[model samples]
Structures are given as C-alpha cells and as structure tokens.
Target: MAFITKTHQEEALAALQDLVAIPSVLDESQAKPGQPFGPECLRALEHTLALCESLGLRTFKDPEGYYGYAEVGQGEELFGILCHLDVVPAVGQTGWKTEPFTPVVTDETIIGRGTQDDKGPTIAALYGVKALLDAKVTFNQRVRFIFGTDEENLWRCINRYNEKEEMITAGFVPDSKFPLTFAEKGLLQVYFEGPGSDQLALQAGGSLNVVPDHAEYQGSEAAAVASELKKLGYDFQQQGEGIAVAGKSVHSKLAPQGVNAISRLAEALVNTGEFANPILEIVGNVIKEDATGESLVGLFTDEVSGSMTLNVANITITPESSRVGLDIRYPVTLEKETLVKALGEVCAEYGVTYREHDYIAPLYVPLDSELIVTLLGTYRELTGDMTEPFVNGGATFARAMNNCVAFGAMFVDTPDYLHQANEQWPLASLYQVMEIYAETIYRICCK
Candidate 1:
C-alpha cells in the first residue's frame, strides 16, 4: 500500500514552493541579534515553522534563530528527521532556466536553488509525518523535524541546537544518496598565509567547500598571464591589468570532477613569474590540479571509506600577505590529528603558517547495527535495490546526533546537482521519498 497519497504530494509541493521562494543564502552583513545567520535564513526558518504549525504540528523556533523543529507524537525517546533551510549563494551562477530563487514546478521536477540540496527533502519528510498524523497512527516515540540555518557555512545552527535541546535517541537525515550511508569522512578546513608582494593582487572563489569556478589576478605580468591562458586553451580575459579564468564548479566532495579555476590562475601566475617566490612555488608545485592530497601531504585510503580528497577552495594575495583556503575530506579510518600534523609540516616547510578553521570528525556506524539494519532493510524493500550501504565523502546532520545515519532523498543513480547551477528535484523521486519516510517513521516510531 502507498504510504503517501496524492493529497500528501500536493501539500508537499505547495510547501516546497513557499520555502524555495525565499533567497535564504547566509549573509553575515545582514545578521543581527535574533537572526544569527541572516535575515533571509531566519525568514525561511519562520516560514517552515509556520507551515508546520498550520499542519497541526507543534513547532519550536530557537530563541536565537539558530535552528527550529516540528514535533509529532508524545514519547521520551525522540526520533529526529534532520534537514537544513540555509542554502549556498546562487546569485552569480549562470545557466539557470529560471531565477534561482523562483521555484519552477514543471510536469516532472522542481527547479530552484534549495530544491534538491535540502528544501525539497524537507518538505517531503514533513508530508510523510503529516500522513501519519492524518491517519491517527499512534507512536511509541516522538518524531521531530529539525531545521538548521547555517549548514552551508560553519554549522553553528546545529551546534547551538545540540547545546540547547535534549539529545536524540536515533534518527536519519535525508541529505544524501540511498541505500544509506553507514560511514562519512572527516572534514578539515585549513588556511595557509604568508608574506607576499605588493606588485600582485589576486582574489577569487566562493565557499570553501565548493570547487572555485572563477579566479582573477592583477599583477605586473597580467599580459603575459593572459597570453599563457590563451595558449593553454582556457577561457580567460584581461580587465585593467587583471586576467580572469573561468572553470567549472562542483562540490568539494567531488573535486576531482571539476576544473579548479584557482589552481588554473595559480599555474599561470607561476608561469608569468610575477607572483611572490614561495607562494608561487606552493601553488604551482604542491596544490596543482589533482583532487587527491598526494601532492600536499600524501594520500590515505582504506577499503571501507576510500581515498582522501583536497580542494584549494579560495586564494587571496595582498601587499602584506597571501592566504589560501583548503577543504579536505579524509577517509574514516584515518585520524584527524595525524592528517593535521602532516599538513602542518608541509606548510611549515614552505614558510607558510597553517591555521585550522572547522573540523568534523569521521562518523562510522557499524554496518550490523540495528539502526543501519532497519534503514537499509526499508530502503531495499521499497526500491528493490540490491546495493549495500556505503561510506560517503559528504557529511550530513547525521553526524551531529547519536546513533544516526544519512538515508534517502537521493537515489543511487540520481544525477548530483547539489551546489551547482540548475539544481533540481524530480517530483516522482520526492513522492517516493515521502512514501519511504512515512513507512520508516511508522516502523521506527509507531511500532
């Protein structure tokens, strides 16, 4: 029997549209007292909480707009459904069939910035719980849909929520691909800075977790760099002694797949010999095009989690100093301390100072655990997919809670458009996810 019906799908789509209409990108400039992330992000949280309230679910907005959650049922043990309301900036991205903030619903898919990345799955899960409520199903445990506002940035939203709310007993996050993620790699964001030259000024890139799509540098050798860029068959142009290079952008987890604009510009700078000495050497020699960390501090790989990846997400050069930001994902089997020490050694050798920003330790749930068994069994039964649960390079809200794992929202064969232009969520896939969440909620909470 179908767990989510036609009415549920309609309601979910309507809710998704309302949430997607707001440009909830984090802007620290607009941040204030109650709105910690930004005004738009806070607005998205308020709209979602209101929607839940309209649906007869008890909702709670964090005192300081860090996070919010909607609750159903009554029990001491809480089963959480974690999702995020904040999205990455889409203002500069091109090739969108519709405006990035405008939700476009066609016969097949929902097209927008936050559609597939998170907001779509959020609505689906909400409707899934709504189905159970409308059916008057009793539950042995409570279900709470927790929404975060700073997922694309530092995850301060969830951090504050954890400090304030009671710990969840067990749960799943619909933020990654199915058959379910049993393990996730550790994440490290590091900054490297050193004294530089005044003759050159360089800045480019966006979020530290995304492959830089564009980079520009202005220096004494801008003309030479432009010539080299043309010779190398790169898309570049000169503007007032500055040359800009355009490259494709993809999630840092899949860094190997995208052409990094920051690295490309760095290579040209090295060739032109206009940049500072060791800074150019570090960029040209150590952090070239390879996504693997082999060139930086060597590589770590294991059968369970796969190889480590590194992305040179951003770079800035000024008269006083030059700064480079890196986003690294290491295998679950490796220790964070070991990786950090190795990286520090390499940076010190190049006369650059290394500073750590944010670190998320690896999350590994035993494949044989009851939580994995239940979620994996439900996924296989619903989709008839024989693929086993696997490790992921991407971290999720699953890591923030105890005895939790990332489940569904994306299927095994679904094309990944998260954090890229033309982000989309198939209507049929969302409906299917709603049904799965409905059934999973019943089995985990009601039974």
Candidate 2:
C-alpha cells in the first residue's frame, strides 16, 4: 500500500515549497468581488487547482473565487480530503532563520510559514491521490481535495463550497496530528467595548487565532510601566517614549501554553499610572495569569472536550473607541448561549458591552461512526499505532460538516509550530505522510 516513490516525494516537496512561497495571508484591501479573499489567496487557490489539473484530476476553480477543488474517480459516494491554501501573516513574527514565505530546505527538513500547519499536508494529499491514479486503481468512490482560502479567518471558502458544491459523504481534514481528533471544542470570539478615551491610545496583536507575541505602549508613563513590568518580573524593553513586552506565541487553542503579551502589557500599563479602560482592568487584574475562565467567572469544563480556555488575543484603544478581543474555546457540551450569557454578565459589571464576533459550535463524532472507524482502522493497519481518537481544543474544517474528523499528516514525533516563527517540519516524516494518505485514500476510495 506504500505506493509513493522517490519521484512522488520530490514532487510533493516541490509543490509544498511553491505553496509556501506565496504569502497568502488574508488581505481585504486588495480583494475584489470575484477574488473574495485577496490576490495572493486567489493565486494560491488557482495554483493548487492548476497543479491538480495537470495531474489529470478533474478540477474546478470557483467562479466567485472563494474556493476550488480537485477530484478523482467516479462514484455516487464522495470522500473528501479537506485542506486550505491560505496561511497566516508572517510580517511581524521574529526569530526566523529563513524568510517565512521562502522555503528553506535542509537535507532532513523544510522550514516555512505554512509547511507544517497545512501546506505540507496539502501537497501530500494531492500526490497521494496522484500515486493511486498512477497505479490505475479503480475507485469505488470519488475523492475530492477541497481547497479553501479563508480557513484562518471566516471560513468563507468552505461556506461558499457548501452552498454551491456537492457535500461529501465523509471526509478527513489533514490539519491535526496522527491517530485522529474526534472532538473539537466550541470556539467563540468576543469583542468588548466601552466609552472612548482621549488619553489612552494603543494597539496590539494580529489575528484572533494566534496568541499575541509582542505588545508595545507609547505614553508619558512609559517609564512607570517599565518599572511595573520589571517588578512583576516580565521581559520588556523600554525605549525613549515606549515600552515593549515580549511573550511566546502559539495557536489560540493552546492559549494556556502561550504567554499573551497583550494581557501582560495591559496589566503593566494599568499598574504604571495609566488610565485603565474597564476591559483593560479586567484583563490586567482578573485574567492575570489564568487562561481558564475562572477569572471571568465562567470556567466550566466537561469530560468531552477538556478545559475552557480563554486568550486575550488583542487590544485597541482610540480616541473614539476602546476595545478588547477575547478568544475563548469552551467544552463541546456547553452551548454558545450559555457561555455568552455568563460572559455578558461579567462585562456588564465592568461597564463594557460584549458582542460575538465569531462563533463555531463544537464538533463531536462518535467512536463507532463509520467514518471514524474507517479512518481509525486505516491508521492502525498502516502504522500499528493503537492510539485512540481524541478530542482537542483546536478548530478545523472537521468542525464544518457532519461525518468529518481531523485525521493526521503529523505523527507522534512531529513538532508543532503552527502560528509561530521558524515553522518547520522534517522531510522524512512528510514523505511518510504522503505514503499514509495514499493508502488511506486507496482503502476508502478503491478497496
């Protein structure tokens, strides 16, 4: 079943490098009606679709340009390999040995922004189907590789696909780690605002899906803020008119594992004699070191999806507006309304208003479902890994539809560098991923 060859491996790596070279981060300024996400994303989408088309797979580029797909074989049932071409921004991240958009290859590894998070797996899946096609295997089902553009933000691509394309009978997203991920926590992003302040002016963080790594404040009280941060034993540098604090960034799903610079800066700023917005006050004192909702008075965990994690994703204060962004991942069993109600009560006490910016209800598939059993069984037969399907805090396209779960391209030894600087993945492991996807596709589609 290991049908991938040396040429297959080389081609997969080359395609991955090509994809990583595109800075396909979301850019609305350059977006037009036909190209909904932006020019770069549209380029990535077209590039991937064209690559698949060259391999003799039936491909379709969406007319509106929100999504595209490549398909192989013909059958009534559709099996999907979910993937996204767009990546997160790499503009302000630090500690890169090579350019984030430039793929730097070593004998054993490749380093790039989208290498591990998605682009690597995407190429693997693409060639996985190609290898099976080369084998001339008759497929009992049609396997489609769905390419999305706005996965890191609003999921407009997948939404448009659902509206216009045929739904998959079953699918697996290659975004998570090996074995499988059967449950994903509910994701809720909130925007809290209060009366504007002429005195406070600050902006921090990038996307709500990533923990902010750096935050800076420029004000008359910069030196005071520096003193406070120093007393609190936080790492910061104070320049002439501003103080900047640095922290570790990780995926928002793993907020507990990251050091949120936004929350730290807010804490230091308020303690250093600067006027604090009520939202800032809450972040500084209440959610100080706890990523769980205990500080927000809404910490609730269930057995299904583990802990309720919260992240101080971003902060912005202007003369006319004061706002803070909170990224919350809650237990799958918890309803969105229940969580929002509890959070709104807390915000009201601080004289701040709470509104939902984005919401994706939790996804859970039973272990006995045909889709899970098939994927889990394929993984077991190939690797002899007895690991069971598990739940996670991260969100994937697996959560977007029914009978879908995140099945891997990452193995047990693969390092996680999603949404971080110097993201890299081992070449040997990635080739193995291609081999696995090939077999899995064969089993699900052909045999």
Candidate 3:
C-alpha cells in the first residue's frame, strides 16, 4: 500500500525554495507608503501572483493592501484555499544556526522564517492548484487560492477580499496544527493604559500574538521581581538595575500556558508591588489571572478549545499615562460585553482606560459537516492515519470564508516554529502536504 503522487514534487520543492529566499517581514515603516507593508512582503505577494499568472490563471488584487487572488476553472460554487505570505520579524542574532530569513536544508527540514508559519504552505497550495489545472480537472466550482499579506500582525488582507468578493463554499487553510482544526478561540488584542511613576523600567515580549521569549526590567527595586523570576528558574540578567528575563516562545497561546514570559513578568511586577501605578492595584484587585477572572467566558475552561489565554505583548509608559498592550484569546461562547464590563470596572477603579484595537470572533466549523468529512477522509486516505479534527488558539485566514477549516501543512507530531526564530518544515512533510492539497483540490472541484 503506497501513496505516490503524479504531481511534480521537484517543482513544488523549487517553488518553496524560491519563496523561502524572500525576506517578507512586515515593514511598519513602509506600511504607509507605496508598498504599504514593505518591499519584501510585497515581492512575496507579487511573486505568487506571477506564478499563478504563468499558469494562465486569472489574478485579482483586492482594493485593500493585504490580499491577492488567483482564480481557475469556471463554476457557480467557489472553493478557496487560504494562505498568507507575510512573516514576523526574524533577526540574525536570535541564536539561529543559519540565517533566519535565508532557508537552509538539513537532512529532512527546511529552515527559514515562513517555512512552517506560512510561506512554505502558501507555495504548497499553489502547487496543488497548479496540479489540478495541469491535470485538466473540470468541475462546477471556481477554485481560488488566496495569498494574504497581513496574517501575522493583522488581517487587513482577508477583510478587504471578503468585502469585495463572493463568499466561498467549504475549503481548507494550510496553517496551524493539522489533521483538522475545528475551533479557533476568539481573539482580542488591546492596549491597557495605566498609571506609572517611571520608577520601574520594563521591556520584553515581541508581539501580542506570540509568547515573549525575552523580557527585562530596570531599577534597584526591580530586584524583587528579578529575584522572584530567578527563583522561578527564569534566565535573567541584572544590568545597571535592569533585569532581562527569557522564556519560551510558542504559538497557540492557550495550548502552551506557562511559557509566556511577558505574563510571568507582569505577575512578578504585581506581586512585588514594583508598579506604583493605581492601575496595577486595580488589576491586582480585579483581574487575578486564572482565579478571580473566571467570570469571563473563555477565562474559565472549556473541553473544546481549552481556557482563556492572555499574553501581555508590550508595555509603554508616558507622563500622561501607562499602558500594557495585551493579546487575549477568549472562548467563542463568551460575550464581548461581559469581558469589556469586567475590564471597564477594573480600568475605572484604577483611573485607566481600556480599548480593544482588534476583535476577531472565534471560528467554529462543524466537525460533522460534509466539508470536514471530505477533508478528513482525504487526509486519512493519503496518510493512512485516522485523526480527529481539533481546535486552535491561533487565528488563520480560514475564518475569513463562510465555510472553511484549516486542513494541513502544520502537523501535531512535527516541530512547528511558527512565528519563532529559525522556523522550519521538514522537506518530506512539505512534499506530502503538497500532494494532499493537490488531491483535496481535485476531489473538491472535480467530484
């Protein structure tokens, strides 16, 4: 019993290598100018669209600066395979054996920024669509492979696409943990402003969506917080009264709870009374981490998507106010107003203000749906592995469609370096994923 694909693996691998060579880190500086994101990310998108155009496929770039689409076949029902090209910032000094952006192939793994996070998968999806087109598979649905640009920082790309285009039927996104992802917890990235006296200097945590790997504090009184962190076995350095604490970086924040460095640092600051701001007192009184905040929906625990998760991404202090930007993934059943009420209470009590800068509702696709059955069956047929669809705490472009689920690309048994240093995907796995996607596209479109 062997599963071999007629799809061109060499072409897929070559495309993946070419995509890996591009450094598509979102440029905050260029976000306002011509490219909006940056030259590299825009190049990544253009490269994808050009590849699609080479296949004689019709391409469309939505009005919003974040999305591009390639359409093939002509039919009433629309099927989509959603993916992104943008990647998080990767630095060379981040303890990587090879350059973070420049991908290097080991025995089985392809190491680079978007290797596993997105770029590799995006290429795989493109290859899959190419296979279907080359095979002359005709069906009643128009298949669109959407490559988004802002999946890392924001979802402006998909938002703009959905606003102008028709809704998709059922499709899969090759992001996040695989087999199948049935549920994605609701997400809210916010800025929590509070009072600060400039007595404590705090720094660490790279982004809201990712767990912070490095954080530090400055000040003599910070010793208490540093000492406590040291007691907790955190890799911390004390320099001129400032302390740097290091923790593990993980995606799907709710799945990996204790690895959040920023949360741990904030806890230490609160416990040591290092934050003289009244907001600190209020947060300590009301939002008691996993305890008092249980009243919130996802703040509790659920059998499906687990409990509420929080990652305090960044903290800023000024003469007028102090703030902590937080990324929270709550449960879908939880009411936004209820959580806002609780936060508002704490903010009012502490003379602080709360604002939700980003709100993406949890995406829940029924496991029993035809789309799920078809996708799951196709995966099992290819891999001969019986696995159930699961949930993810990380958001994906699948949520942009009316009926779509993240199918493959990332797996449960593999090491997923999504949004981390030296992100990579096994080359063998990449080939298999391309074949799976090819079959999935053909079956959905030609059946």
- Model 3 lDDT per residue over 285-373, tens place: 33333421353222455677667776656665555667776677776567667777777776675678788888877777777788988
List the candidates' TM-scores in order: 0.73, 0.72, 0.74
Q: Residue by residue across 153-235, what tens digits does model 2's lDDT show?
A: 88999988989899999999999888899888888999999877777788999899899999998888887888899888999
lDDT of each: 0.86, 0.88, 0.72
How many clashes in each structure? 0, 0, 4
For model 1, residues 250-294, the per-residue Cα lDDT tens digits are: 999888889899888888777776555566567765777878888
Residue pairs whose backbone atoms clash in candidate 2: none
The lDDT, on a scale of 0 to 1, for candidate 1 is 0.86
Worst 10 residues of 3 by lDDT: 289-298
Q: What's model 2's lDDT at 258? A: 94
The model with the greatest lDDT is: 2
Residue runs of model 1 more than 4 Å from their true location after superposition: 27-29, 88-107, 111-113, 191-299, 310-327, 341-354, 413-424
TM-score of decoy 2: 0.72
